[model samples]
Target: MDAIPYLNIILRLTIWFLLTADLSVANIIIGISIAFLLPRHFASPEPLREWMRVLWEIIIAIPQAYLEAIQIMLRPHDEEEIVRERVKPKRTPGLIFLDIFLITFTPKTIVLKYEEQGWYKVHRVRRKISDQ
Candidate 1:
């Protein structure tokens, strides 16, 4: 209701019009006409601000993570390498059972497969929006 409080609404409308303007200058004219024709709702700005921040962070983090994954994947590695297990092999049945139980219960990451000379994949979903 105060001066310049309507700035974001004006800016968003301008963006929407600009987005639609590629059709022609007629669209640009139409977009401009709409700014005047539309009444300002002046809704509370908090929800919009929170969503903007969340969307922005997601836009930034997703590509960064992808780039990181690519970097790790493309890094040079020796075709043949040997490493010693830091701990001696265990023969405990209870520990294995407990491990299985925990892995099954955990949600975000899932173990695809595990074995000697086999591959294991962990799938994780990034939570972007928090439940209010």
Candidate 2:
């Protein structure tokens, strides 16, 4: 009954239909039905101010992350160099989830696993000049 839930369903239906790219009435109906049936575990509906702040931070950091990826790729790894870094605990589960997704967007590093100790197991490609 809430506007937010209706909006959420509409958004999900739109995205689903768009991705599927079938404009048939049946498909549209299915999309709408599924959207309504899907359980919504939405992130906390905190103030937009905090969300905007986080978004700005991510935008500012993305370029630096891309640059680091480029540098790592350009550097010759004559032998395979894989480094693992332990990520520090984030303030919230949402932040940790966001960070995992953001880090995966970078080229030279991939998240291998999440450790029990609240550290991420990241596999980074690094080459030591001394090794060559």
Candidate 3:
């Protein structure tokens, strides 16, 4: 019984509320029950510092995502390409999920899959550069 479990429950409950858009007592009860009942598997303990770093990255990604969306809309010539990105070391399930979520949250990129040896297969769109 650590803070991780409590945090997980809170996160799940928040997501449930957001998805359902319900504030009724029954919905709250069901959301709490489901959050508690969901299975969590972690290979090792995730440090609070690492979790906070990921949370900070998530917060930063929101504005970055909006900017990317605006750039994509404004740029007329763009190119799409698949690229491999190196993942951060010592990733837990939650961290990995957040990594993927952060990458995919942006308008210009989506993670296709995780490759062997800590690489993410990402599809990205960028403005086409012109030779001057």
Candidate 4:
């Protein structure tokens, strides 16, 4: 496989430096060296629109998650009241991983199992009729 281009190497190095919070000359040199050495076979950039959509979903999910978590904690736990459902299948592994991470933020909902055919067994705290 061809080595990743210089632009991508620089981009990854910069990101590595930022994430590590080590901007010293020695670290920068090491980052650059590792960036060039690492394989970038799966570095496909996502479209701007997809990133925006993901951001919007996160913005909406945050408040919903907080509210649901509070409700779950306040209510008495009942095994019979838990809900189970399978969500739609995601086309890509990245999307599946993202969905799992995002949805698990809410305490009311927990992913119990993941299987092929997009089958995800989720446990959800039952909502009160008044809250519904």
lDDT of each: 0.45, 0.65, 0.86, 0.63
What are the per-residue Cα lDDT tens digits for candidate 4 across 23-46? 889988888888878865564654
lDDT pick, better of 3 and 4: 3
Query: Which scores better on TM-score, 3 or 4?
Result: 3
Give each model a TM-score: 0.29, 0.51, 0.87, 0.53
Q: Write the per-residue lDDT of candidate 3 for residues 4-120, one digit (tens) a residue.
A: 776667778977999999999999999999998888886787887887888899899999989888887787536889999998988887778889988998888999998768999
What candidate 3 gets wrong by more than 4 Å, as runs, is: none
lDDT of 1 by residue, 72-128 (tens): 466632233222222113412222222333333333334444444322333443334
Worst 10 residues of 3 by lDDT: 1-10
Give lDDT: candidate 1, residue 32. Answer: 64
Better of 1 and 2 by TM-score: 2
Q: Using alpha carbons, what is the TM-score of model 4?
A: 0.53
lDDT of 2 by residue, 20-103 (tens): 999899998899888989876675543444445555676877897879767867787444444455655333444455567666
- Global lDDT of model 1: 0.45
Q: Write down the RMSD of candidate 1 (Cα, Å).
A: 19.8
Global CA lDDT computed for model 2: 0.65
Best by TM-score: 3
